[model samples]
Target: MAEASANIGVNFPPFLNSSSPTFLPSRTLKPEFPLTSKLKPNTWRTKPLNLTAFAPSSRLTSAAFTQTDDGKFQPRIEADNSRTGRVFFLDVNPLCYQGSKPSLRNFGRWVSIFFEEVSHSDPVIAVFDGEGGSEHRRLLLPSYKAHRIKFTRPPSSKRFTKGNFRTSYQVIRDALRSCNVPVVRVEGHEADDVIATLVEQVLQRGVRVVVASPDKDFKQLISEDIQLVMPLPELNRWSFYTLRHYLAQYNCDPCSDLSLRCIMGDEVDGVPGIQHVAPGFGRKTALKLLKKHGSLENLLSAAAIRTVGKPYAQDALTKYAEYLRTNYKVLALRRDVDVQFQDEWLVERDRRNDSTILSKFVENNDRNLLVQPSKQV
Candidate 1:
């Protein structure tokens, strides 16, 4: 994937200046959607976003951050403590496969709704999966995400072909650029790593962050300062996952999430679980071990002295120490990727609202119009 250029010649908001040390205070706006609600499993309401819901008066207000002379971002302080500035990191890869059929219409509509719901004052940055995004992971374990290719077959419908997927991605990229949302795709790097790096950078600045994607891999990054908003296609709504939610779901700290995945393995990514190699070892067993040992490394240390879990569990750990260690490397997200946060990537809410680019794209590529088959290119 190619790197997206910054929006040139656009004026930065006052708080966004590199030399400023404070963010402008803005009144807190209640989220239109529910932040925490219990719902039945596999039950999602699949309603399209109401475009008319975006009221003209709801424009984004304050700038995201101000930079100091030393090139470091200074955290914004609200005199009244109303709302801290927020920046959204949008992972664009999962959006491509959101609906039953993949098309530019599906992707574009979601993108529009996301920008519409986000506060105009906060910045939004889009991250795309770069070319060979999975190569590095594959090198760690050749089976990483290899199942996707192994199970790949020709799509039943031409509309769902790889070509259509690429077209949809391109159209969305163009639309985001036109609206002044920074679109980033670092070559040879996965968006997961890129987003992880960006999250780390922003956290150091003391700014709040929201990552928009349905990928569970991001769970490891959850914290008080950073939250995740996942799309619920079946419900046609977005769900928020915060540190509380992560704790409730995992019964463990976010830092231990990587170790949990390393032990349990990820079927979606084609990583084999300890169960595959050690019979009768499953999620419960993995969780128990993790809760006690805290991490795979610690568990291995105990196993070295034959003090970890039951005899069989200890035997498995000692026998497959190399395998478990490799899994950790495969599952851990990189925080040192060579991407930096740029002020130019901040969403210019006023310009975005005035632009007709996204609306036009949605109108032209409406889902109804994409049902018909297209000529093979």
Candidate 2:
């Protein structure tokens, strides 16, 4: 992945790594979307003739100092408006590894590593995979995420059982709290939904959002100001993307949130996208239907057009309707999560100080890492 241009105000004047801190101008003017296609606009919200959202400022606000002035401390807050951009790190499987030695340590390790670097660039927010604490799909469809059910099973040994694993979750939760990061979990909802809720909210507020996760489902969230960063083999290095980038790859416009996603049902999340409708075909059908009936609902129920010979169209309509009702139950992110933004969540690192700050993380005894910190958020 290409790193942000150093001339872009990256803080590398006194750092160890070849990489430079990305100083995103919080005041970047939102880009204008030009109309070039004849696609119907009723089914999907037309790309506003002037589509713009919150753009992250290139600088930090009230950049308080924790290190020395000579750059020995490697300024933690480099950009002018520090808190301008909201960075959210979504943990897909917060408890993916619960059986190994100090299993919960994985969460700690990920958290520390993320903050240690982000603290130097932007204000970061983290949302962990709550083990179903909030309103989840179970209320709508009990079979949702049934595959991961083994995770919730009661452990025979108190130390290894589901209850114990949750206890370990509490440990990881406490560590995040001490760091001042927001840890959220809705009893019945998944972490993805919570993260989505946050992304959607920020996007609406015009604040740029960067969701950190490798899951393909998140691709749907990519927009002008909103982007994605996927971790690569290199520590801390990530692959970034925008909606246009995705359009280039898939050959379909992503501005239409429903048309784009409805056709390409997410298999990972068990969403059987548009029954027999091929991937890009959903986009076409959605556009055509929207042009005729004005909305997915109207298209599905249009009596005169129901006889169209496309089996995929009928199936698509059925699935689309079912999805409309339950997918949000499944896909719409949740903002009402009990999680609250905290200050300590921002991890700070002195680039000029020492490699050991984050280097020590690569190899440490899980036990020494502290399962749960004393503080709570």
Provide the TM-score for each candidate, comma-separated. 0.71, 0.55
Best by TM-score: 1
Q: Write the per-residue lDDT of candidate 1 for residues 245-285, one digit (tens) a residue.
A: 55556656456788889888998887888888998777888
TM-score of 2: 0.55
lDDT of 2 by residue, 252-320 (tens): 334334444544555544555654444434556665554344334455566335654277566556645
Cα error of candidate 1 at position 306, Å: 3.1
Any runs in candidate 2 off by more than 4 Å, and if so which? 1-84, 92-113, 116-121, 131-135, 149-166, 177-180, 200-206, 233-237, 255-264, 274-295, 301-329, 335-377
Give each model's clash number. 11, 39
Full-model lDDT, candidate 1: 0.62
Backbone clash tally (model 2): 39
Candidate 1 runs further than 4 Å off: 6-83, 99-101, 147-168, 346-348, 351-355, 367-377
